[model samples]
Target: MGTSFEKVHDYMGRRVRGLWQRNGKFYQQLLVEQPDGQVAPRRILLKSTTLDNCRIEMAQKRGIRDQGEAASEPLEIPSFAVCCRRYFDFHESLKHGLKRQTTIDRERWSLNRWQVHFGHLRVNQVTRVMINGFMQKRLRGGRNPRTVNIDLINLRQVLKYARDCGFFTDQERLPTEGVKPLRYKAPVRPLLKDEQFGLLCEKADSSANRSGPILADFIRFLGFSGGRYKESLRLKWKDVSFELRQVTFGSDGLSKNGKARVVDFNPALEAHLRIMHARRAPDCKYLFPSPQRGGKDIPASDLRGSLFAARAEADLEWVGFHDLRHFFASYCVMSGIDFKTIAEWLGHESGTALIDKVYGHLAADHKRRMAQKVSFSLAQQAASPAEQPAVAAVQQSPSAVLPLPTQSGESAATTALAS
Candidate 1:
């Protein structure tokens, strides 16, 4: 066996800040030559305030051999497996501070699932046929088209990386180019006005269950305010300035979208919140605490559970916790809350496009209201004083009048003839 040694490669690519950053740092990768003669390259993620030190430290962590490691037996070409590992490592390395690890984890899971399916094959072996076949297999097994499309997206990224690394020369396009994603139509089952009021009353008065009342109030708060589930859970007592009657959101624990919105408290919701506030611990900060008693915010599972239980008690069906969001917008339209204000409450981008796309029908009633207004305006125009004077003038004129024949003249002619 040749002088056995581990080889390391430091990828001095882009420098960026991430979750674990003091200031800025360069990323590193390591490849080891096993005694079995298989060369394996691995990425060791590292970030430091100084890029220079990060490079040096990355090299040091590569292995003990410093001398001919770089030149000795140029590290064997990495396999598809190694390539994907590097791709994720690169992705994690460039992660921005605002990016949530949950999102990264979800993306990583999708990528790795694809890898497990086909990472063993050579990069060049991947063809559109192979991709379509895989998708067909997944779809035949009852996977939703949306899921298959997600897998396709993850594969596209992998193939792109392979092309970039010169594994294949097909610069023309990705294998997924011709693939069309499945269409998903959002279900349109908005709560009727009476149904919404009934649900709220049920939540407020559910005395049978320990968790029902708190969960009910929280749900009602969401229904009334159009706040996201996580936003509601993350709400702090400080966020609500009862004096100003304004509720501000927390900067640190804002939702995944990183948006904070305030809702002008309706008198009803404000009263309910005040009652909940009185029960809140002075030091225990969160407006909604986990029933288990030790967490920053209530677990999503609890919220889901409470929602299901309340729905059961209220005999309401087909409405999700998020449907409360739709309910809010729909009720807003019914109550005459303007779309712009409703969008702001829902944390939507300004403009009717997204709002209309998601809840266009919710605003249908508004369209009807507008139509009614137009009809009323036209009716008033037809009966206005200006038109009335013209009608009176026509009625007063003889040319516009019709005369009736006189029956008395006919009767007098008949009498004269008899005489």
Candidate 2:
């Protein structure tokens, strides 16, 4: 018989050795010959408990090698659902600190949506066609491109985790390659007018919710600071400097960007914070503590119903809590605050790109006023003798006579010469 069919431990560029564990279990260690004739060992647990069965399996593997066939079944790829669980666990195990609970919840929701369609499919089976189909399905279900892209982002992360775990060796297994996220233009978020904001606050303060006043003040605080909804809620009295009129969002404050930033307050906001400080419970660590739970940060859900109710009462149903922040940026731009200053106040680390994208469009009134100011200044400058062409023309044409009014008894030429 050929050496390939021999019951020897090594054959055809591969070898299998029996390994006995201390617990009496047997394993098959596969040694594959490298291109340079070096052997690389890979240990695989044996399903059979006895060493005889392991030898039999090894002989079978040797027989397959003799026939030039693969000695084992293809490696099993994990399903999308399994990959998502593993991904979440991996993120949870990171030492740097996991994402916020709300962010994880959002990821869970997005992954669940993906699981509904691709859970049974192996991670390697997700192709560009499958991803495109998912995008089409989401669009048909009335999801916007931006919303659909968020799901894609979550899916991509899961696939990347799978790749990192050695579930796939082929680059094509990752569907994110040619699969482009759908593009959609976002509408400019509207800002509340001064009168509308005042009315909204008035209605919010008088609403049936016992926390109505607190909610109103919270909205005003967001407007003044231009802080994100969560950032504002995470504020503590210690972060505020009454003497310096500044509020610092530091590492302990849970800023979105994970960096420290200081925002200066106007005189109005400083006074507002001082008043709230006086009414704050001494034990409360949060600036906006929940009325129901003293010393605890206010829950976002607590104010949703009241905010919508107040908006309805003020006849400004289009307004939202985030709009207050937008209102601050919009008015800042309109009032001639530079984009850099606005970006700093908003805790943006990437410079003014965001400000220019969102708040660069000034209000019509602001644009008109600016145009008028420019026109008046230019008109005044143009009226100066140094700026006029008439003086230059007269100097260039010495023979040119001024057309003088014929004085009561004087001729025109004589009147001109009187100078």
Candidate 3:
């Protein structure tokens, strides 16, 4: 940093606050509150050379920009908490700000903890050692690597903002630079299989209560459509179009992506919807009305308790709502539906990338069944290399029943001929 700047004085010869001169022009630094409610500095070129001109311009600019905040003092970089608040307030204005409300909510939650950890420290006071200690403490406190990384992320967002505010300049070592994010090993949960699905449905079907059949239909809907927990609960009767073979999930704050989506109906999804439609309450709009809502017309908040009971009775207590969702995807894949189409049905934002990452692998029998669809013959060589490459693929089709190297020995033009 420069040791000094030529200071601007008032007409009465008193040094004016936050007025500096460089290259025969004056600059005025004004204090203003950011949209998210953090006070920060904003500098403006005064275009003034003399003290009278500088003072007059400064007063005029302050009247236009500054709100009712206190007079500007010597511009000092605010504390970490201030910088954090500033960043969060203006996050929407940032080029790479958080797009999803859920992400913003999660990041804010993470930063709240961080604020209590180092809120009092100046931006420059937060060091790499403190960050490393916080990481260890979070891990020791029973947070997984992924959760602890949230804290690290929130901390770095502020520090990076501080850097933009002119704190760490000229390739300085960042607090989170050497700290490596721990590799996240996602724990595998139980997936519903064909027999387990039947067992659960049987338990629901055999239950001795009004909620039994409803619960059975709910499970069927989830298995058939891959609807998320709340999305299914929020589903309405009008959203189903049996004629169109489509079910729509409108944006009702329950969708994971906060947008409406339509799931194309398969045979099972259609059958499940028709069954539910026959028994749906005339007074209610939701597909799954609350099991307890006798006279009240409302959607079921959750069916976890009912699901748990059903799972226990069926001796498949490890099953969850997401297991059925997985079952739907797996069922589609086994039926030979492409992943891109599955992702759209599942309301995924990354198209097929997430589906392929999570649901790509399947049972060994299924893999073998898919593999058998490919065929090859090991006994022959081609008469011509060029001819072989073109015809070989057609010959390798598993549908081909060859009596010779590349011939099926039957023609459509002559079904049967006199030999």
How close is every model to the real structure, measured as TM-score? 0.63, 0.70, 0.66
Better of 1 and 2 by TM-score: 2
Q: After superposition, how far is residue 75 of candidate 2 from its true place, in Å?
A: 5.4
lDDT of 1: 0.63
Give the number of the best model, judged by TM-score. 2
Model 2, global lDDT = 0.73
lDDT per residue for candidate 1 within 240-321, as digits (tens), equals: 8889886765455546567677788878668878888987766577777666665444432366766676666666766676
Estimate, for each residue in 20-47, the C-alpha lDDT of model 3 and write its tens digit. 8766667787776643467777565666
TM-score (C-alpha, index-matched) for candidate 1: 0.63
Candidate 2 per-residue lDDT, tens place, 83-154, comes to 787677777777775685567779999999888987888778878887889889999999999999998888
As a whole number from 0 to 100, the lDDT of residue 23 in candidate 3 is 66
lDDT of each: 0.63, 0.73, 0.76
RMSD of 2: 12.2
Candidate 3 segments exceeding 4 Å error: 1-78, 82-105, 123-129, 153-179, 206-211, 363-365, 370-419
Q: How many backbone clashes does candidate 1 have?
A: 0
